[model samples]
Target: MDPFHTYTALSHQELGDRLFQGELIIFSIADELAPFLNRTKQLINKHFGIPDPQKAHLALDEPTYAARASETMTAFERDPEIKSLFFSALETCGVNREENFYDRLVLRIVPCVTSYDKGRQASVKHHRDTWGSNIDSQINWWLPIFPLRKARSIALYPDYWNKKVANTTSDWSFSRYLAEKKATPSGEKIAYPSSPQALESIDEQACFTPELQPGEILTFASAHLHGSKFNLTDKFRFSVEIRTVNIHDVKHGKGAPNVDNAGNVPMYQWFKQIKDDKKLVL
Candidate 1:
């Protein structure tokens, strides 16, 4: 029942082998379930904080979404177990990051609604996660803040990088715009592909569908092509998308200036309390 031990036992690399080169790796943590579930309830306490399925209300800011991101980041970071869970999970996956104790090494939290109560489930279109330059190779640890059914899950294409998506000068080049039209009709729109040939090359790569229960963790490469599916159940799908990168590789691209101003963003955030935090204790 020791979460850390079980997490350590799970061969993330083997999970990788089962995956296509660029496929996302999905797994869950056994040790941190109690605390994680508690945190989810806290986020939904109507008397104390914000409620879900509702937009920023008269009492809340119009951009309550951004505020929620900050709140979720702070809540998860405060829990030491979640911190250990992330680092251990990352190491299990063969990713190496630079060490800077107090920098925000972790990135923003992405919350998506796949299904709502009785309404059509919100779905994200097909697209790569992030494309800002200077953005070092990053990955996402997707954990459902609450339990999720297999049917109301995310869909991802394996080896997306091998697909040859183009970004040429033609007016018809494959940019985020076309991707929005083709993939995510409501979510983010992509610009031009960073590499024209890379898209087609990685096409037809196999992918896997994963439904993450509470405390389950799914990690995948930054460049992997992935997207979420509709949440068909009546209950809300509360999940967090935690993005991270190697601290040593922080200075990689045009994302540098923004990264600099962001004050090391997610990394600085990680080292701040990872050591003393007990949430990591299985």
Candidate 2:
């Protein structure tokens, strides 16, 4: 069977099962998803003060661009209405927003080769989300606020989906990673801190990088060995990333195989409860 498939009329649970089996599920833009993505685009525009967020890095220096990027990420996280749009969008893809929990939405500003990172960005290494979150049932939803045309923007090493590659999970911990990330000096590179990364070289020919439209959603198992290919494009890449888990699947061990992750972080409790929206640390 093809590893990548499109959404049709399956129930959310069925969708979860396919994703758990390491399938890349694609859902084209729908009604609720439009407003949700538009709201994110609006926030990006507001903070960066640019019509094309993909060029925002060119408008400011390293520090100023970082500040605006931080503000945009924080504002979207703090706004309750934006989150409502998120769940509403998920429902259109058949997720039972009432029954599942979600991690905070993240706005990724993947800078081009010419942009300066200064340790303010997420890792671009080949790794699995489960290496950091330690949650097998976690499914990631990836979308571009603008059309993505660059290669490897969100590349997946599908050959490594069920295959083992030497990684740093055995020596990593989320708490320590967070502490060190916070301690990184100004203008210093994070170098992935405590996040797990492939210690072995990966073959680029086996990678699959989907060039998704603005509102198209890409869902895949958090354990998939995915990472960004360097931004060779002249403009910055602005995109949205959301992570959610089915509690039932997590509890029943019904997700992706732990092919190689040996990390010690148990982040299941970090998700916001769907009912009361209260933070859980269990």
Q: How many clashing residue pairs appear in each of the predictions shown? A: 45, 0
Candidate 2 structure quality by residue, lDDT tens digits, 1-282: 356777633576788778877789888856657888778878888988867767766677777777787788889888887888877777778777556788778777778754464455644778898988888888898988777884626888788888998988887766777777788874457654546778999998888888887667889989999887678787778777888887777667688889888875678767976656766444
Off by over 4 Å in 2: 1-3, 150-152, 185-188, 191-194, 279-282
- True lDDT of residue 117, candidate 2: 48
Question: Candidate 1, residues 1-282: lDDT per residue as tens digits?
Answer: 111112323343353333324444555455645454564456445322655533323234424544454455456556565555556544544544332122233322223332121111234445554332223344456666656675456556653455533422232232454464565432232333322222233332354556567666776654555565544454445565665544344433312112111112232223222333222110
Error of 2 at 242 (Å): 1.6
Q: Model 2 — TM-score against the truth? A: 0.91
**Shift of residue 50 alpha carbon in model 1, Å:** 10
Query: Which candidate comes out best when scored by lDDT?
Result: 2
